[model samples]
Target chain A: MKRNLRIMVIDDENIVGKRLKPALEKEGDIVETFTDARNALERFSEQQFDIVVSDIRMDDIDGLEVLEQVLARSEKTKVIIITGYATVEVAQEALVKGAFDFIAKPFKPNDLRTIIEKAAKELGR
Target chain B: MNITSGEAPIQTDDPQFSHHGLGEEYVEDIALKSRPIISIRFRLFLAFLVIFAFSMIVALWSIYALSEIQVKIRFLEAAGNYLTEIQQARRFEKNFLLYGTNLEDSLEHLRTAESILQKNKDTIEKILGRNSIQGMSLQLNNYHKVLEKVGEAGDTEERNRYEPELREYGGQLVSDATNFVVKEREAVEDALSLSRRVPFYFLGILMVLIIVITSFLVKNILSTLNRFLEYTNRIGEGDFSPILPKRKYRDEFSQLGLAFNHMIRELDKRHKILIESHKLRAVGTLVAGVAHELNNPLNNTMLTAGLLEEDFERLPDEEKLDMVQDIIKETERSKVIVRNLLDFARASDYKIIAMDLENLLEGSIRLVHNRVKLAKIELQMKLTPDLPPVHGDEQALQQVFINLILNAVDALPPRGKITVTDSKSSQAGFIEIKVSDNGPGIPEHILPRIFDPFFTTKVKEKGTGLGLSVSQGFVRRLGGNITVESRVGGGTTFTVLLPTTEVPSSVSAAPSP
Candidate 1:
């Protein structure tokens, strides 16, 4: 059997973290979630994760910073950016920052799960 | 507290009123506020009339003086002739006494002199007094009697007696005639000198009157013209208040005032529509942010509902119910966001009501939240809690704040801070609200004239140059004002001073200039 994947989801909206934590956990993987980007970044320094999922817009630290910080620590980790406004500039910028994938907001949990699985598959390489 | 965020439509709150802020009533009302036509021409005519009457009086007095002088000169000539006749009679008397010549000629001269005295008795009496003229006539009769006595005497002794009487009367007559001629000539000279002085005196008085009238008219017209010149300057700065009557009587300038009021109404109408258009443009700007903002709640709802559907059978009742509640709450949140924007886009009159500046300021900040977020600017507000309410139009005030905030956002780089601070002003009954940014400050040269209409540093597409001009106009109309302080490379702050009140303001009566 494949090893359990590690995932962290950061969104300022508490609901996103609360709901996504349980939904992703059903896949038999460990998941961490944060409603604040600062706390999320603090927690991120203490451990290693296989994938980082973060909303692009945040109060203190945005998703692009999370992506840079995550990659600076562990290049193997996959960073996926989530955005409420999926304009081309943001999508292009996120992708340019070594983000593994970009997803617009309001997507079904399964859609994100599929991207995470793909990111997981790539982590094995 | 947040009526704008409420679901009920804003228009229903004031059904009797409409978005059409003004109508033709004001134009007609102002144009028709005319008093009687006390035109400038009428005033000039009255001035000339006074001058004309004064001139006629002077002319008539001069004519009277000339006539008096003529009468004196005529009487002087008659008196000179009487003197000549008396002297001639005396000469003839001397001849008759010396050579025994015929006395007829002397008698004839005496008769002519007496006739002259008789003919000019009234005039001579008027000049020399009734008593003096009568004494002179008695002397003349005595002299004539003496001469006749000398001529009628037959012996030398008789003639000798008459000779002394005749010589005495003759000397008296000559001296008296000379005195009358000298006094009457002096009277003629006095009358001529008086007539000459009359014209000079009239000229001095006329000059003084002309100066008085001319200065009065010049000052009246000039002061009014200066007032109008100042009015043009005020109106050019975007003050649209009508020119009201300051004088008791009307004049041509009053008609000009009416015309100014008319022009102001039209200009104000065009400016209102411009502001309306700018508001629409602002709404357009907010729509993009609003659309992006809506997705946050929608995203939450989607994630929650999706999970609920996937785990519907396996989930505990509590978990399912929580997901359902989350979905409902998120939907309600979405509704409020949309409603707030809709209320701002709706047009309203300059309706004055007591409003919480804190709530209104916060709402304005929220409207531009997306623009600020997109630019990564840090926007914050520090309002003193429990501050008294201010009187203003809610929609218009929101626009004012939003414009200020948006301008700050545009001027800032990413991570720049925009601080909105408010407190009670030092002036009584007013609150001062300041919107400040730490971005590269506006240059000092451009600071003062930023409130001028069509004066903008931004590109044509980005700015209509009416934002601050329109904002200042609105605030002044409500008896408030906006001021700005800026330093080159330091920062910029816009302070809006608003009056706090409990009653609906009679601000429409306020002269905005």
Candidate 2:
């Protein structure tokens, strides 16, 4: 039996969080979505997750900062950055901060599924 | 003919006054335009002809008057010679009588001398007749008869009996000779005076005529030319309403004025037509831009509806999961189209900030990648690693790059290559972006109008033509420069120069020079 993996999605867009929640849930993962990075960070402080997927640009806090906060709390936890505003700098920065991989916006559901599986495997979930 | 080298005397030749307030380039262009493509040589030749004709006429008149003076001088000279000869003859006759050298013998000698004198008189009349020594033949004949009467007294005794008569005859001879001498001297003086006075008068009259003729010519031609120049200056200053006046003489200037008037009328009509066309094109561009914005969301809606229709049939089955994937994909597509539509139609208050240049360029490239793929154009980028940040709005700069990329794609034939390059210009303190194409370049006539709003080389249906112009506006708003260089049939290059500054979180920093 595959244990249900814990996943947190941080994105400003309501539709993205809404759609992505069910999609990740259908992959047999316990999914959590926070439209606010600050709230997500507060939630992240009290809990543990198998993987964290963050959008690069948000109204309150950027993905790089989100990566920083998450790494500060738990360096071993997997961080997969998802962003519409992907660039070499963002990718390199996210990767250097111990993110799993960087995915661009409008990504296929399979891409998300694959990344989350990799994170699950990395975590031995 | 001498060009005065001393400070060039304020150059009235340069028509511009300081107050007209145009740039040096514009003024220089105006000045160059003022000197039309008229043949300077022809004008010089015409001026020379007028002067030469006047000089030749003066020369001919002077020659005629001088020749008349020469004739009078010759006539006076001949008369002077004749008077001197007559006085010599009388002196010779007196010398013979005073010395009482051989009375009857001298009278015989005198007769022989008279015969010699008569022969010489014939020669004198012959020479004087060819000259203008008028009325001198009769005087010579009278002097010859006086000598004959003195010589016809055959003997000295007969001569002594008629001594008083001889003395009286001698008195008459001396008196007649003196009177003749006085008359001839007077005639010679009159002729010499006439010779001197007539030439002076003729020369004076000739000088006056030359002055009058040259003044008339210069006034007539220069005033006419000044009028032409004034009108041309007005035309150059964009004032085209002057009615070109005609001359009754039907000269070359008149013909040129008529032709110029016709040309200006034609140009004015063409300019009006061009203005109207430009307005129509602007309206068309607005309509097309609106249409393109509307079309994107419409397309997304159609794709979304199609996916929903497909997904409704696959429910409650093993492939229901596949149908969910399809729905998600379709929804993402709809989101993309909606986002693009908003970006295109959104009113923007762009703000500039110091941003990482490499990141900005990559983002712009990603934004336009789908279009590049759709156009079948290759997008080649060569971004220098560790490049500095630039001061600009990322979105606006992205729009500029996309506009240039789209323009390049349209300019190219299918599958052609478009290269986007980035490099640091140390001297400019800016990041230079070059988007170049290997397409057939813009036509020569259309090159200047490339950045004008609504001026398009593409067909009416194919382009709204606001891309380059809007790019220019955006670049300018960001305190940057965007310019295009095109070679007909070779290719086109769009260069965007953006001011570079410090990036906040970058590791390596460039030294400020």
Candidate 3:
């Protein structure tokens, strides 16, 4: 029997986490979600997550900073950035700063599920 | 040089030519049309020609009149000389007749008088011609013969007879000479009168010529300048009506008029561009405000829709599943509209690259193919093979094409057609792509407002109204232009012109992903 994967979702909007948490949990992964990024980062240091999905824009501690801090804390954690204000520069910036992948908002949950599945496979490897 | 009242003054709407500017500062109160046609160069030339010709005529006439007077004076002197000789001969003849004892002195006087008479006869012949002098010459010869007879007479009676003949001859000679002098004086008077009249005739002809030439020159120069001034005034007032076409003679004024018209055309173009850019700026600000307000709500809807889908297993019924699907679908639609608004409002950090236009068009068509199929709309693509690449952001350009295609799909009824064609533009270094539809066309009244933000004819659920405006913005950012033409019952065509780029060797021939 394989051990369940650990995934964290961070967004300023409450609905984003509320929605993504159950979706990832349904795939037999342990999912932790947060609306406030600072609290998510505090929790992230206490426990290791195999994947971190974060919204780029937030009230405090944007996704890129979260991505850097998470990578600095643990090199193996896959950070996926999501943005409503998606542009080529923002995506490229996120990817260059060690985000595992970048996706625009208003995308399907299945799209995130696929990226998470690939991230999980990489974690197992 | 009087200007007629028939000509109208130039009118213009330009602020520079307003009453406070050109009217008050530059132009005088005199009606421009009523003002005399004044070309300084032509006027000066005419004045110079008239003055020079008049001076020449005056100089010539003075020389001619003075010479005539001199000839007349010479003739009078010649007549006086001949008359004096005739008086001297008469006195000598009378002395010879009265005093026979002083015959030697009388003969001497007679000989001197004969010599003077002979000299005067030649002069009179030269002056009056041979016929008038013939009688005088014969008279003088007869008087000389009579004198000889007096000198040779044996008695006083013979001498007295000869003296009477001599006196008769002398009297006839004096009368003929006096008659000749009087005729010469009359001829001189006639000649002097003719000389005086000649100058007036020449002056009359010259004056007529001067008037004709000056009038012609003044009118020609004045009318041309008047037209130029009128054109300038109209241009200053922002009226862009073309100037009069150039005349056959390509003079300085003609060249100036051509250059002036060219300048006006350029100014008009710049003014139009300035106005359009200002409109764009205003729209940009409005779109930014609206987009920011709409984005969060749209995001929330999308997330909530996702949450519904995530809890789909626990929702308990198929009806709920259908409703969740509807929410997701509707939310996706709203997200597209919000994205379009954001795209229009946001200042894109444009990444320009050499992109194959044919590939871009094909990819865009493929993106909307499913919708086109569902609508039963026929898609026709006629891309020019080996079409040149254009410099633009692929995603932005794709958005423009996708928006156009979707609009075409929306406009069409079942079995309608959408045709997209691309070709090299007739203008150098540019390519033209046309997206056309055979659906019911856009109305004429709303055609001008098609590119305006939030302007749409579609129902609230069907459109966000930002599509065409955002497409136009994207094209403009890529240094291209998009325009549309539609007739009421006829179909609509949207043409986009984009600048071509030189593809670098490193770039692959494959279409952009």
Per-residue lDDT of A1-125 in model 3, one digit per residue for the tens?
Answer: 33488889998767577667766777888999999999999999899998899988665577889999999999999999987667789999999999999878677678898898788778873
**Model 2 chain B poorest ten-residue lDDT run:** B1-10
Q: What is the DockQ of each candidate?
A: 0.58, 0.03, 0.11
On residues B307-384, what C-alpha lDDT tens digit does candidate 2 reach at each position? 445445644665456545655665665565456444433444555567766666666675566556546678899888
Select the stronger candidate by lDDT from 2 and 3: 3
Q: Candidate 3's residue-wise lDDT over B248-310, tens digit each?
A: 444456446556655654555454444345335434543544443345456556655765666
- Checking candidate 3 for backbone clashes, the offending pairs are B14-B237
Say which candidate scores most in TM-score: 1
Any runs in candidate 1 off by more than 4 Å, and if so which? A1-105, A108-125, B1-38, B52-56, B145-152, B155-157, B195-199, B306-319, B346-361, B383-400, B424-432, B442-458, B464-485, B495-513
Candidate 1 C-alpha lDDT tens digits along A1-125? 44588889999999998999999988888899998888877887898888899999886788999999999999989999999989999999999989999999888899998998898788772
Candidate 2, residue B54: Cα displacement in angstroms equals 6.1
Poorly placed runs, candidate 2 (over 4 Å): A1-6, A26-30, A42-50, A59-61, A85-93, A108-110, B1-38, B46-77, B95-143, B153-513
- Residue B209 error, candidate 2, Å: 13
The lDDT leader among the candidates is 1
Candidate 3 Cα lDDT to native? 0.70
Of the candidates numbered 1 and 3, which has the greater TM-score value?
Answer: 1
CAPRI category for model 1: medium
Docking class of 3: incorrect
